[model samples]
Target: MTAERTRALQERFGNALMPTYGVPPVAIARGEGARVWDVDGRPYLDLIGGIAVSALGHGHPALVKAVADQTAALAHTSNLFLHEREVELAERLIALLGDPGARVFLANSGTEANEAALKLARKAAGPARPVLVATENGFHGRSLGALAVTGKESMRAPFGPYGTEVRFVPHGDAGALRAAVDDTVAAVIVEPVQGEAGVVPAPDGYLAAVREICDAAGAAFVLDEIQSGIGRTGHWFAHQAQGVRPDVLTLAKGLGGGLPIGACVGFGRYATAFAKGDHGSTFGGNPVAAAAALAVLDTVENEDLLGSAARTGAALAEGMRATGHPLVAGVRGTGLWLALVLTAERAAEVQARAADHGFLINAVAPDALRLAPPLTLTPEQAASFTGALPAILDEVNP
Candidate 1:
């Protein structure tokens, strides 16, 4: 059945589908908790969490109920009329961040949220402020506005002439950030933890320094928490761990559990920059999506998932490190977010071997394997991964 589905999918889709993603492998059918079953009924323990999007795992009762209830009530009313779920979700998010007055602009993905943030920053700065500063290895999104500010050349090269007035500063270098974000700059965007860059974290005082610099220069401080927010880092937002507040905060990824949703949150004076009708989305803040997100938030709070993530993540890291296998380089990250660096140049081989052993992980880079399991993961499941790691390393390293 699995082979038949794969064949049929390939034949029907063919080259008709965009080649952006590589050839597909197994066809996933259903999921529950941190486990997913393929068409062949093979179960794989998911550690990537759909690339950090599934906060409550596959099918949580609360999320299922919220989505069903809201859809039955009012799935979408268009941005023309305000909806109750949207208002409630916005209020919940604002209260979660301890910023009651923060205004929110909802979208469908992380990139769109970032696009809204960029526009809001530009509008706040007016026409005089032209330059926007971002960090090296920092990823915002794929839209032209977000892409223009992303630091990776490989991701940006295809779409040249994205726009004028954008600068890149070295990540974790506060002095370089200060020098780049001058009065002419409209905003300085950063990711508290560079998720795509092998789980690299910013240096101590980096965020605070950026906050100070942006405050001094009157530039908007925008933190793209798409991957690091929604309790991935054991915090509602990773920037909170640094004790810094950004003027513009973009969130998505895990926001909707498994559903699609995004938001650009503006604080203090920046919240008032976007006047009526300045920006909007047809599907943004759909009642169903908001309900899904609200369900995720409520589940996290009720389950004490944040504290569980921190405790389990630390144990997993410690267990992996205690292996002391020569092939194991180190472990770096916080909460449920982590990466296993390998001394061998065979991260891909390790991932394949792990799959053969009924585990799922991601080789985010050639030498780095990333793990972002669902916040609701059991301690036993986490320990199972760590126990199997040494053998996986042996198979690859041998």
Candidate 2:
């Protein structure tokens, strides 16, 4: 069944879809917890967790019920008429962050949430202060507004004439950030953890330094936690661990579990920047999406998945480190968010071999393999992967 589906999909959709992603042709039919069975009846432990989007895993009962109930009752009512779910979700998110008075603008993806954050920062800065500073190797999104601030030259080079006057500063360099962001700057956008940059975390005191600089310059501090938030890092929001609060925070990826949802949260003074018609989205806060996000939150809290992620992740990291596998240079990151740096250019081979061993991982870069399994992953599952790691590394290296 899987092979047939794969063949049919490739034949009918050959090159029709964008070529951004390579072809693997795994026909996934259903998923539960941390395991997914391909159409061919092959079960694989999902470690990427849909690129860190499936916080509650696939087809979770709570999430399914939330979507079903909300869609039947009120799927969408447009932005003109307010719905209860949007308000409820916003309140829940703000409360989760421990910031009650924060205001939220909903969107459908991390990039869109970031787009809204960029707009809010620009609006708050006025015409005189139009410059935005972003960290190198940081990724915001692909939209023109978000793309302008993304620091990857490879991605930005193709999209010339970007809309914003953005400056790129070195990640984890507070002195450079302070120098770049001044009174003339509108905002300094940063990622608490550089997810796409192979799970590079900000240096100690870096976020706080950025906060201080932004405050001194009267610029908005926008923290992009799209991939690091929602308990991926064992924290409701990664920035919370750093004891720094940003003027604006963007969230998505894992927010809706497997469903699509994004939010731009503004705090205190930044909250009031978007008044009346400043910005809007047609399906930003649709009831179904909000319900899904709520379900994800509920599952994380009720099941104590945050604590699980921390414990399991620590164990996995320790085991990987113990291997002393020459190919494995080191392990970095916290909670379920981790990356293994390889000494050679065999990360892709390791990923493919791991798949053959019924484990799915991501070779995010040539020398980096990223792992963000479902928060509900069991100790047995973690052991299974770590136990197989030495052999996988041997296969790749030998």
Candidate 3:
């Protein structure tokens, strides 16, 4: 994109939009597969995949047709009325979860899904359990309830006086998590892989330990899979590798392809937490969104994109590691959700340079470059990123 055009759009965005996001340098015109074009027609590889929401990639044919056909047939129907799409989607989700007894509560986004999960825990535990425990640096949604349970202080402190008493422990530390889980705990919410904290995975056996501790304490075990779920991490759910199941699972991000949708799933006794009229959403399970979700689920299974993501991600991470760049410290995380650890806090510079050379990546931390490209991203595209790595690094440190 031309500097003049980028500057003009930036100025326009600053004048018209809220300051929460400030202004992005590029104005995307359109996208196809894993590539997007700027307003001025410069193409760039989309490595972030809308922060792990675009599992099928840009303008996927099945997703497009599903959304379009469903919208044309039936778009919105509040929870007051039953819709076939919603029922079918629910059944599919339960089946995919490998828990036929699991109950699903759909929402508009990840935050709302997490909010609903929090309420479920609170309701199930009653007033007797007054505390919630989460891992330090674990990023849940920004809603008041989810934010309260979230471990990041800066994201929660500005809101002041959240109703829940949340305790934090060092992530991937089983002893710390066990110490925090007492009879007074309502729930222990954690992300299997810490997304915003530079793609940090839970230490092997850590999640299973938390599951055991929470079981002993009768605390709800809630896994917020908002970023790592829906085939991004080579599994339907990242915690599956631990061979344990969470009592409550919050999902979103890639649930509806590009459409906005989320779900809070409760299993076994936790399924009965919300009573009649206990909780609800007006547009949570819209027919169109459900249809889109069904399509995404179908595509993942039929096309075997999960295997592709796992194989491609492993190769990409290995190639990056072999590069031996001075900035490269190590590769952490798993499957498609991996990060390049840097010896110096120059992630922003690296990301900016990569984007300038037609690749979009996220600087998740001061020293970590996160990669969550679409599950459908080809191995060739992964190689392309590794091929361009040296120049990207040189441009940053030269």
Model 2 C-alpha lDDT per residue in residues 99-143, reported as the tens digit of each score: 888999999999999999999988988999989999899999998
Give stretches of model 3 more than 4 Å off: none
Per-model C-alpha lDDT, please? Answer: 0.89, 0.90, 0.90
Clashing pairs in 3: none
Candidate 1 lDDT, tens digit per residue, 106-146?
A: 89999999999999999999999989999888888888888
Candidate 1 deviant stretches above 4 angstroms: 1-16
User: Over all chains combined, what TM-score does candidate 3 have?
Assistant: 0.98
Give candidate 2 regions above 4 Å deviation. 1-4
RMSD of each: 1.6, 1.5, 1.1
What 10-residue stretch in candidate 2 is worst by lDDT? 1-10
**Model 2: lDDT of residue 203:** 82
